[model samples]
Target: MPDSIAPDALRRLVLPDRVHRSLYTDPAIFDLEMTRIFGRCWLFLAHESQIRAPGDFVRARLGREDVIVVRARDGRIRALVNRCTHRGAQVCQAERGNTAGFACPYHAWTFGLDGALNSVPHRQSLPPDFDLKDPRLALAAVPRVESYRGFVFGSLAPGGESLVEHLGPIAAVIDNVVDRAPDGEIEQAGGVARQEYRGNWKLHHENANDTLHPGFVHESSVSAARGDPRDYAAPAYDGHQTHTQMLSNGFGVREWQSLSLTGFPAGHSYMGGFYRGGVLSPDRDDPVWREYRARLVARHGEEKTARVLGEDRFNNLLYPNVSINAQYQQIRVVTPLAVDRTRVTAFCFRLKGAPEALFHRAVRFLTNLSSPASMILSDDIEIFERVQGGLANSEPEWLDQSRGLGADRTEAGGRTVSAGLSELPHRAQYAAWLRYMTAAA
Candidate 1:
């Protein structure tokens, strides 16, 4: 592939079981992805709970666009471009806060929370024909915004699939998260943990559900946990969640093969949970989990609670930019800074009526998996950079994704399932990538 990729050339870049290396290294391809993939798809923005009150807002990224996700006084959530319409300066600088309106720093042109032009610095200086109500003078708003079980998403395109249609069956994973709460609600409790890596953003999603790499890429952390008896000595130990989680990644070949991985047509996928007997395990009977279960039972009854707690999916990827582990109340959002740079922001949720200890466990899970100093994520980040560095070479122009290509079995719901170690998720993502990259813009 050349530096300048045409729409027709994109199909040849992504094959049945291999993808061209230029997809990761080409600046032109990355620019096209920003407009076609991220711009058209419904990218995850802010959780509804994050901005529950009127005037509350948080700065977010919509592909290459900086946006402010705000709740207006009329109880509506709106995403507005952060740039000032007057002088092209950023209108909001804060990460998150509550305010009545935003005033541009370069000039005093102010806008309402809904991105409506409210006032100008010097109204008399403007021509009499200039109207304040002109839509072009206000901040640019994302064309479409929707929420599914409180997880907000925005699309830059004016028309496309609705959020529900786009999510397909993956919405059930989100439902499991919210349904686990006794009050049927979850809120963003802890502050976000962000880490920047020197690699393409696609690498994160590619590695998210790859069960085979954990035993190799994260061997140091997994071996350390395996060598420590404290990780597995006690069944009810609550403090060793991180160590136990590390140990879970050290599963043998047979154990990994026994697990199941499923891929969707829309680029979403998830793997069956591998943690069997740790505090992070769904079937664990620790006191904190017992209390949490009892609370859920009180609200949802025995059968419903069992169904909620029975879900065992992990690393649910929502296409281009989001990975959710609803079982642990964790969400990681990936943002592409450049062709070779990416940022991941992670947030943990608190079950509205569950015990505080459960929320603490969720926080610990988030830290162990996504924090800058995380044992697992640091290793993955190092490998991502190394992959990026290696791809700088011109040889080996194609990356193989045929690990388990011929063995995928389609289930009743149109999802393809395979052995856990298969690279089906990568292929699924590329299928969607090709569709978006080749579509008419």
Candidate 2:
């Protein structure tokens, strides 16, 4: 297919610190990522809360396949192919909804919640070899579906590592995402905002862990956050309006100097605590924060809550699909539709029963600043497009990520660098990328 990675393309990607430009720009390499990286990894499916009731479902793109994840009547979540078994038409066309069973509009074929082919409109006419009881007739399930905490994940390949094994040391970070909530239960709140940006999926994924860019790129939103919104009262978008946002994005570089990286066996690496939390959403005076802290202390005790809250990281870039930002209400799921086009979904959550103001605060931070409409997000989008455009130059082919070389301290499972300023995270990411790209070799 178009995403296939050729040997020559593989040779272009210099090992360790640099990736060949073609890896980002080439359709072949992007396909390899889909197969080698996305296909094998335990891709984020959906939060358990979204499908709390049986039959609730959400449609998502897994590499090239369109799959629907639904809670079955048995209370088990199932990820089934959206394609109809008969004539190949897509089944369950709605983005998401509660359905006792999915009925194919074409030919009246129907499938049960478990993806079993329950009925075929003209079944008696079929040949003896075409058995309705055959598993092949069922909506093909994603090979493996697993959930860690309240987060759900599905994999296309059956041979790879188990979900926990793939997560490695980083699973702790994933668990932290939901466990910090009061009573260890976090709710999906606010709403989900999706936008299509003119950039490759990698740029958005990398920037999620980018503690360095917020200061410069997100200045306007920061200004809005710092500024009294009542004063501007919906000001028009101007290039300079992003001054505050850029400054906030700038805070990443300055504040994230303490990140400790730990590379794992899989292409997954955990880049620890780049941001000193309680700043954007302080736990000291904020009632929501106070309540969250009190509950956590009561449950897990002060020491554990301190550990959970103190090193609040900006995010954990879990290899291919998921970007689980530890602090705040941000969870971005990337769906790469083609070699060039990408869909980024941003979801903001409330802290269970925490204050609504906190939820509103997250909405403003995401919609006004990080959303596609935000001036800050646009700047990053501009860079990704320009970078993709330039990669087609066909001369001088590598993108340099060797910022702080020789400093990635070797730990038990992986390597790490304490200084957040170090491009240790970037190095860790590329290291993981190369391993997956060259795994078969």
Candidate 3:
């Protein structure tokens, strides 16, 4: 597999119901994906609340490119490549902080919040033709940055689909998350948890909507939770929500089949929520939930609040990089470090005007599912590495994705709906992957 894989060759790698294993194991294919897929897609960057004040900034990634997402003096959000124009050294080092300007350590070349070249230490040492205002001297800016409901996305390609167009029907999921906030705002809070695994990046998204895997891959946790004598539903019970979450995955095949999985255009997909009891349940009727419900009803009226809270979705994936669980105020971003290594960063948001306890629950949800120490995620990471190791073999070059191959049906909104355990989501993702990877330059 060459780096410049021809369009026809790329087409052969992905069939309607399966894909080549090399797509996951080949270094050259990963290199091509960094540009063709990650570079061109509208990737989730940072939420508006993260950079609320002028000079506020956070480090983010677009494929292999390190970027600084900042609020400039003009109060507009901007995404600039972290590299300084002089000698290509990173200009900003801190993970996140408010700074008047970024001064490169390699050479004191400073850039403003808007990525404009501000000053250089040895100005006179440069040639006389060196113009202070030269656009080439500034940090490179991501060509397009757009936001919908405070969720910002950036595209490295100079021109492509607009952010909304790229999001397709997936935009409603974001709207649902924001609408759940009583004040119609959500902020990144409780920091982030990052984990690295020795697996291809696509495995995360593939496993996200695979309902069948939980009963099998997570059998140990599920069994342990089931064997515990503690009554999770007892009013006086005090325990982490993670126990309830683990118990939720113990659902039998019939219950799992009852859940719906939907795949939209552009590789976006989501599954029906499965948590049925404990604080994790959407309709949990405890005092804290009642107070949060009252605040929401006061803000959006009873009907709208019910609708907002009633939208039961889990693991909504925005193709190539992000997995969003809007109902839980959780998001996980996938960053491909190499062909066999990837990093996932998870963050939780606080719903403005909601009860403080609700936000705490969200943080706990983030930690229980995504933290490096999480029992659930640790199991998945081990499996991912095992799959990567298994793929090293030369035999059986194709991975089948034909579970429920002909069962998917298109809905009125142009989205595909499949049985809960179907592999339609994987096929849908590969469809989008082929389109982007093989598109004419």
For every candidate in turn, the CA RMSD to the true structure comes to: 2.4, 3.9, 2.1
> Per-residue lDDT for 137-205 in model 2, tens only?
999999899988888899888776788888876777667766666657776766677877666787776
The residue-by-residue lDDT of candidate 1 on 1-441, one tens digit each, is 322567778988999889999999989899989989888999999999999999999999998899999999999999999999887999999999999999998888899998988998788989999888999998999999999989999999999899999999988888999998999999999879999999999999999988899999999988888774745656645566877788888888888888788888888999885554343584566788888898999999999888788888889998888988877899999999999999999999999999998898898888888998799999999999999999999999999999989998888767889988899899888988998888776
* Cα-lDDT of candidate 1: 0.89
Clashes in predicted model 3: 0
Query: Per lDDT, what order, best first?
Result: 1, 3, 2
Q: In model 1, what lDDT does residue 96 have?
A: 95
Off by over 4 Å in 2: 1-11, 128-130, 219-247, 252-265, 269-274
Better of 2 and 3 by lDDT: 3
Q: Residue 298 CA error for candidate 1 (Å)?
A: 0.8
Q: In candidate 2, how many Å is residue 219 off?
A: 5.1
Give per-model TM-scores: 0.96, 0.88, 0.96
Q: State model 3's lDDT.
A: 0.86
Positional deviation of 211 in candidate 3, in angstroms?
A: 0.9
What lDDT would each prediction earn against the true structure?
0.89, 0.71, 0.86
